[model samples]
Target: MDFQKRHALIKEWMREAASMILASFQEELTVEVKTHRNDLVTNMDKAIELFLIKKIQQSFPSERIMGEEGFGNQFQDLKGTVWILDPIDGTLNFVKQKRNFAIMLAVYHDGIGQMGYIYDVIEKELYWGMKDQGAFCNEEKLPVVEDVSLKEGLVAINSGMFATNRYHTTEMGLASSGVRMVGSAGIETVHVASGRLAAYLSYSLCPWDIAAGKVIAEEVGLVYKKLNGEAVDLLNNNGIIVATPKAYQEILTEYLLKK
Candidate 1:
């Protein structure tokens, strides 16, 4: 399968996409609301996704692509090699802050994740993982997060979860060292996978939002699951909690599992 070559190829494509996105910041954006006022999409997002899909098609013509920007394939099953991408994650951040957003992509062969890449575009840090090979930030291998309890670690929670108090999210924050809101699932999950944060809980997320992070989380030994403790279903937009093992158990018992 030449998995190493495929990994390198995907990373190269991501770098090119990142360059396109960075160049767009100098010009005015063509932005529109997708689902609501806060749900935004910019021309740069669509352009980057198209660029990436083109690169993938030129390199791996047989693989299917599922992208957040509606510019890729529509598939009913995940039976073969598939590329999942969120071209510009945290679009709001990109529009407003212009720095916290990221570009994420993951490769799944026969329904098993083989590689994941999350590029913090402005930060210039690339978090990538290959199945059985471990995860890395740029060239340095990332260690599994330390086994920390809720009280000892920082937690990241999404705005929806915080607003609704979904699964007692406020209580969960009180239990942890503190709560952080990165506004970007990819960046938040990268923090968890790299031990900078103990966990990230999101009330709603589509496959592209977490797919890349999931691959990296698995490689780093973090647990990825629904807030209710069920396995993550890659096809569904559901509550997600990705964290170090010990913190997972603690948050599940003390916060999510509670009424």
Candidate 2:
């Protein structure tokens, strides 16, 4: 199959899905809890995911989907063509700001990310990538990451990751040039992909949260790994470090060490 051609089709569908999200932005959104009070789901989230599912089924009937809204299947492994999707990556932001939330999706074949797309629904900006074509923001080609030391670079992490015990990420990220709390994994990942931040650290995030961004990062020569230098596991939720090669290495060595 032509990965490039599939990417083009995904992008168009992604944009259409994004537009549907915008139409319901300001209205009162129904919120529900999943595992905990902190874990939230909005009506828009389900709507968008369902819309994408219908679109994907109509357009790519053979592809399997694994999505956050539970509209897709629960899979053990991603083989053949798999689409990973997050209808609304930042449900809180969509509820509050009606912006900053994004629609993230990835298409993988044979366990490799073939295409990725992240649409910042509010700004109408789309960040997309393919296996070797590199990443793009809107129509502009994204510049490959420039090497930067972790100490002199910025890191984005939500409050939850910093509060955890599995890694010394809190100290490491603080020691960097600065730290940003975006509350949205998809947004932070886009920042890392587009070179706004040197890295993005998040612990135990769903596939929909980072699948698309992983493709974008890889295309730009970034290393998308775990906190302790393990490879990113596509099938599980875990801490992730999306960084330029140099920054990723620095993080593994100089930081994330037990005190």
Candidate 3:
């Protein structure tokens, strides 16, 4: 499928998207609530989604796209080439901090992830992975992360879930060295892939939230799975855990599943 060619084009598009996002900081953002007060969608989010979708259509008109801004196709199955996008993964962070957010995109062929990208706009760091080609941050190739046990390393968990002790998340945090809440699934997933954190857990995350991160993280030998240790369903939202292999097994066996 000429993955190298596509990868080159995708990287170019991500750079363009990053430029657009950075430019928006100069102008006043038009923000609105999505499902709730904290769930935000800015004008830049819709603009970036539309912009990337346009670029993809120009090059790969036959492929289907699913975007968080609802500018792309809506379908029930992943039968053909499909692109998933999250224009601004941490919209609240972008609005409040103007940093720590990322743009995430992923491509799948017949439901198998072919490539993924996570672009940290402020940092200008692009994390990407291609099937069997390995994962990288900028020009540096990422290596397989150590299989650190849960008790030995820090963990990241959804803030609300940890505070509420949902699914015994607080206990899981206590079992680890510490807990962090990055507020962005894309960034947290990258942290795990780069060995910055031992594990990442979220009570609920949409397909776009974890799609790109899953591809990139899994390529670095980390495990991506549902809380119950099932494979993620790319078409639906699910409780997720991305971690080093040993941390994954320990998190499930000792914390999440224990009665």
Q: What is the lDDT of residue 128 in candidate 2?
A: 88
Candidate 3 similarity to native, TM-score: 0.98
Residues 1-259, model 3: lDDT tens digits? 8798889999999999999998888899999999999999999999999999999999999999999999999979999899999999999999999999999999999989989999999999899998888899999999989889998889999998898997788888888999989899999999999999999999889999988998998899999999989999988889999999889998898878877
Against the true structure, what is every candidate's RMSD? 0.9, 1.7, 0.8
Order of candidate numbers by lDDT, starting with the best:
3, 1, 2
lDDT for model 1 comes to 0.91
After superposing candidate 2 on the true structure, give the runs of residues whose Cα lies further than 4 Å from its correct spot. 163-166
Q: Give per-residue CA lDDT, model 2, range 157-241, as digits (tens).
A: 7678676734677678767898888788888888888778898887778878878999988998889987778877788887788
- Candidate number achieving the greatest lDDT relative to the actual structure: 3
Q: Tens digits of per-residue lDDT for model 1 on 114-203?
A: 899999999999999999999999999998678888889999999888878888988889889999998999999999998889899998
Off by over 4 Å in 3: none
* Model 1 per-residue lDDT at 163: 78
Comparison by lDDT, 1 against 2, better one: 1
Best-to-worst order by TM-score is 3, 1, 2
Listed in order, each prediction's TM-score against the native is: 0.98, 0.94, 0.98
